[model samples]
Target: MAAAVVLAGLALRFQVPGAYRSPQPWRPEHVMGLVYPAVGAVVLRRRPRLVVAWLVWAIGLLAALQVVLQPLSRWAVAEGATGAAYLRWAAFWIYLLEFLPLITLLPLLYPGGRPPSRRWRPLLWLVCALIAVNVVFAALLPMRYTVGPLRVDNPVGVALVGELAAWRRPMEWLTVAAALGCLASLAVRFRSGGPVERRQIGWLGYVLVAVLLLGCLDMVVATPFALWIVPISLAVAGVPVAIAVAILRYRLYDIDLIVNRTLVYGALAAFTGALYFGLIGAVNLAVSGYGALAGLAGALVVGLTFQPLRLRLQRAVDRLFKVERDPYRLADRLSRTVQQARDPAAALTSALASTRQALGVGGAAVEIGDRDGGVRVHGDGDTADLPQEIPLRWHGATVGRLLLPPGRHDARLAGLLARHLADVAHAVRLTADLQASRERILSTREEERRRLRRDLHDGLGPTLAALALSLDAARLRLSTDPASVSESLASLRERMIATIGDIRELVYGLRPPALDNLGLEGALRALADDLPEPRVDVVVEDADVAGELPAAAEVAAYRIVQEALSNARRHADARQITVRLRRETHGLTLVVADDGVGLPMTADGRVPRAGVGLGSMRERAAELGGSCTIGPRPGGGTEVVARLPLSSARGAPAT
Candidate 1:
């Protein structure tokens, strides 16, 4: 049908008498008529059920049909064929009758291809009735119509042209009312539709607005050349194109961005141009003799003010379009809050609030861990049921998810939020770990203090008291009985030696005396030698045996080895043990393997619960920014491995 319309239009232009001989080379109406129908035809093929597309196609084809028939009708009448002239006239009037529905019903049924509501169905019928009435009046009326340069009598009139002509004014008023009603329905749809629908409506609205503005301009200016007609015709042509774009949803979201930037940049350019010209004129007036300097000063002023003007225009445009959410501003505000926040949880809460405000979304939340029972929410309120979840990641691991209110998913906004919140999430995780470490350190310290107190009270204090009494007795007996003094001296000497042994044992428990003299490697060698039951082998790599390690690292490594050996002897039922230490670029690595029964296992085949010894060893290494691992060796024995950094700056103080 679209091809036929184009062919017929071309045939009429070439063959019809004096019709194709217009002075103007290009006709806007001709182009619009051909283009709108072709566009509609393409769209209709894709969406066969779209009533609006059919109407649009019909409107365009009928317009071109009228243009073609008018000249043919004139040629027929000039050749003295009244019947042929009346037939063409009837066809023209029928095509003209279609205009009412095209304008009134098209907008009402657009996008959805249906009426706005059931109540509007009656109005649609009324519009059809009006078009039928107009067609009937045009057919039966005894009126004579002008076809181009000739006037021909209505050959098939029923002698009712006077009454029909009288009714024309009322029908025109009704047509106007119907068109306004259709526009109102469109406005209602635009108001109620979601973001996607709104954008589709916006495309249509933009063309209508341009046409309306051009109409107003035409009325006010009254140009001799009809300059407003060009833009008005172009806007009419653009209507179908815009509709096709909207319905197809091709780059629909970009329409808003395009409109926003166009308005901003266009306004900025206009304002700057005006300012430049006004400055140049003022400078010219002030320095009439110095035209060059005035021009230079005006250029300088424009160059200096360009950026400020652009920013102001951008803000104005954003406000106008209600696209005021600035991602950078939101990110900056959240960054500052996160930096100043005393706790990670607090920082996350602030970030969620900022995200909600920036995106104009509903309740936002930061949910840590699983979505089920393990979930930890920080937000305005509970967000377990929120549908949208963007993962909050630290390093490469997903530590939590950010839940947002129900709406269209915006990948750009989600990506931006994720990037900004990554640092905060990482900081929160670190803060929690630091707090846990502190608690463990404090608990370990308290336990050590309790052990020291018990040893001092039970062993050293009692022995010291006994020795003092013995010394006093010896001193008193020295003058009274020389024989008693010798016996007192021997008892006091034994008591004193026992108290020194108890004190030495307590000090050894705190930190090995061997470590102070033998260094880490020597200390481990002595420990292996001291073990009486298990055959122990100590291997210190050539690089590490002579290298000096940090004090904290040395202590942590020694304690770890001591704990691992104790665990092996008490739990593994081992007969032999091997300890190895190697030096790397960053730190020292230690490994202890026992040739005994592997780690204790529960009925489920999992490693048994870790005891205090294992926990203390891990904590000691962690305090020095190191790691400890105890697992079954590949060869059926328990292996303990630890890596401690050599630099003091790399470790945090355990106390």
Candidate 2:
């Protein structure tokens, strides 16, 4: 019924004679108003109980009815109809329906199609009361209101009109308050809402800005350009279009980018316009003409500077929303927060709280470990429901996950949080690793001691006792059996030489013989020279530095090189190998490269496994307060690089 009534009114608007019509008969209140009811119908089909769709339908139909009444009343008068006055009066009250619902009720139930919560019920009724008060006051005001192109007296005017006037100012303020309350409701939802909710609100926000700008522009250009409000009011259709787009969920949640650009360009336009007119006015004031030339110059200047100014403003506004652009600042701030925290547990908690505040997300939480084994910490906000989860990893293992609101920028937050968490936990892990390494070293020393004791007691002791017995026999039989004594003495001499070799083997087990015989550089050169299959070169830029290196560092560097060379020789099928040693400021860097089949990698280009040889190299370096990394070399081979720092070198005998 509303659609037919509105359709006839619009058709009659164009068909009515020019004499009875205003200059234009088209509806200026909402150009392309058919969209509103259509959108309302769409929303109603999806959500029958939603008040927003109902409000949209009411607003659209009534606006159309307002257009129809003017011509109907005028026609009724021409026809000498008995209720012509009544028709004109109806037009007066109906115009109230146009803006009241839109600014108040519709926005209150917008996007979500329901009140945010029961707490807002009072505000809803207050707005309703305000709307009712304005209507009653207007009806009883005892004045002619716009009915068609002329004023029409109220048909049901009451004597309380004077009394109502006394309260009108206060009521006006109350009505304005009600309208703002509805807008506040929308804003609150946006701040506390989830990703889907934000995207919905963004649509309304987009259309609101466009309509507002167009509305203001229409007023400015109305008289000067002779452009009717009808033309600019077409932006009103954007409301329904935005509604449909939002509710339907057609595209990505990229509203932030769009809205940011709009703000930048809008401000640019406003500034440029103000400058243009200011320049024109100044020129006209100075010289009694040539304002056109000043306007042209201003236009040219604005045009030339527009792009540069836009870029600057864009960056400025972008910073306001995207705080993740500066990683150093974020990292430094989190680093301080974690450092200030008293304990290991407190570090994660502090980081969570700080991140929540910084991101301005509705809610955030940090989960350490998996669901079954780990603990979860939540920050202050709407963390009741966090839809996005980003995992935090340390040393290629997932340590935990960060739970945040569903948003496009969540990925960036994930990466930042993961890195920060890893850094915070590293000290604890490193301490644990050091303690374990110390225990292993103690166990290895004890095992070495046991082996040495066994070698002497079981093997060397019996041989020496037998040699003593043989010597005694030789003494006793010197005169009686001199020939037999010579043979026995020769056997004793062989036994003594064998004992010396056994002692040397035990000493070598404690410290390599080559390390004692030759210097650290010489040991590395000997290892390379022994590898006959692959041609090897040992390089040390400063030979003196190698000799002067701390004993423990030298040992670590030599062992790392030895293990790397062995691995390359046995596993890496290579034609050439290079052992390069550099004396760094506080440490030694050893790099062993083999021109062989590069390191075997997994399908994803990662090292498949850590071999014992590789692990040994890393342990040796770590014992000397340094690091070792093995990876595929630049051109076509595997390289094992280790650093051995002199400051924390494990205690070893100096050469």
Q: Pick the TM-score winner.
A: 1
Q: Model 2 lDDT vs. the true structure? A: 0.72
What would the per-residue lDDT of candidate 1 be over residues 297-352, giving only the tens digit for each residue?
Answer: 77898899999988888888777765545677756777887878777888888877
Q: Work out the TM-score per prediction.
A: 0.52, 0.51
Model 2: lDDT of residue 591: 87
- lDDT string for model 2 (1-655, tens) is 5566766777666654555555555555434346677787887898787777777777878777777786677666445568877886776677777778777887788876677899999988888888887887776677775434555566788877865687889888888888888888889898999877887888887777676677677677655334545545666777766777677665424555677777888889988888888878888888877877988988997888788988788778868766444567778878898889887667766777667645655467766532113244535455667778777668787666678777655467557766887655544445445665566556655776898889989988888898889889999999998899889889889989998898888877666677777878888788778777788998887765555556677777777887888888888889889988887676778889988999776676556656557766766776666778888899999988887766534444222
Model 2: per-residue Cα lDDT at residue 333: 77
Ten contiguous residues with the weakest lDDT in model 1 = 19-28
TM-score of 1: 0.52
lDDT of 1 at 405: 63
Task: Please list the C-alpha lDDT of all candidates, in the order they appear.
Answer: 0.74, 0.72
